[model samples]
Target: MNHKVCVQLVVAAWITGVPAQIGVTYQIFCQNFCGSNKLNHIFCDSSTLLEIACGDTYQKEISLLVNTFFFVVIPFLLILISYFRIIATILKLPSTSGKSKAFFTCSSHLMVVCLFYGSVTIVYVRSKSSHSAKSNKVFALLYTIVSPVLNPMIYIA
Candidate 1:
C-alpha cells in the first residue's frame, strides 16, 4: 500500500507538473512575443527562462503531448480502474454482517477518491473552449496539492 501510494504520488506530480510547466512555457513565449521582456506576476513569469530553453512551439507541443499521455491519461486510467475495483468489492460484500461498518470504512475511501479524481477530471476532462485558466488552476491545485494533504487525514479518521 505504501509503495502504491508512493508510485501514485510520483505519477500524479508528473501529470500535474508537466502540463503546468508546458503551460508556463507557452505563457512565457506568448509574453515574450506579445509583451515586455519582464513578467509582472511572480508565478506567471517564465518568459526569460523559456526563451533560453526552446526556440519553437513545435518542440514544446511535442513535449506537452508526450507528457500528457504518459502522465495524465495513463495514471488516470489506472486510478479509475482501481477505484472501480474498490467500488465493486464494496458492492459485492453482503450487507448483513457489519454492513454499517463496511459502509463507513468504504465511504471515507470513496470520498477521498472522489475528491482527488473529481477535481482532476473537472480540471483536465473539459473542453479548453469551456473552462478558463483560473478555473483550471483552481481545480488543479485542489487535486494536486489539497487532495494529497487530505488523503491521509481522511484515512485516519
Candidate 2:
C-alpha cells in the first residue's frame, strides 16, 4: 500500500515535470533566441535554470501553473486524503502505542511536506518584479539549499 502511494507520487511528478520541462524549454528557446536574450545563452545553463526560467513571461506562467497544480495542489490533496484515511485506521487500532506511533509518523511527514510546499509555492507562485531580485534569490536559496538540509532532519525526527 505504501509502495503504491510512492509510485503514484512518482508518476504524478513525472506527469507534471515532463510536459512542463518541454514547455519551458520551448519557451526559453524562443525567449533566448527570438525574444530578448533574457538568458545568457541559447541552450539552457543548468546552474541558472531557475533564473532563466523566471526571466521570461511564457516560462514563468507555464512553470507557475505546472508547479502550483502538480507539486503543490495535487500533492497536498493526496497527502490530506491519505492522512485522513490513516487517522481513521489508526483510531480503530486496539493499542495506544500503535496510535502514538501513527500520529508521530504522520506529523513528521506533514512537517516535511509543509516545508517543501511552502518554499516551492513562495518561489514559483508569487509576484514577479525587477526589484525582487534579492528576495527571489533568497527564496531560491531557501528552496535549493535549506530544504535539502532540513528535509532529512524533518523526516528522520
The TM-scores, one per candidate, come to 0.53, 0.65
Task: State the weakest 10-residue window (summed lDDT) of model 2.
Answer: 39-48
What is the per-residue lDDT of model 1 for residues 1-157, given as tens digits with 9 covering 90 to 100?
6999999988988888877777756655563253344433223323223333434644544554565565567776787688778767767877656566767777776676777767765654454468765666677677777888977887786
Top model by lDDT, which number?
A: 2
For model 2, what is the C-alpha lDDT against the true structure? 0.65
What are the RMSDs of all candidates, in order?
A: 6.4, 5.2
Best by TM-score: 2
lDDT of 1: 0.61
Off by over 4 Å in 2: 2-16, 33-63, 129-131, 154-157
Sequence-dependent TM-score of model 1: 0.53
Q: Where does candidate 1 have its weakest 10-residue lDDT segment?
A: 39-48
lDDT of 2 at 38: 57
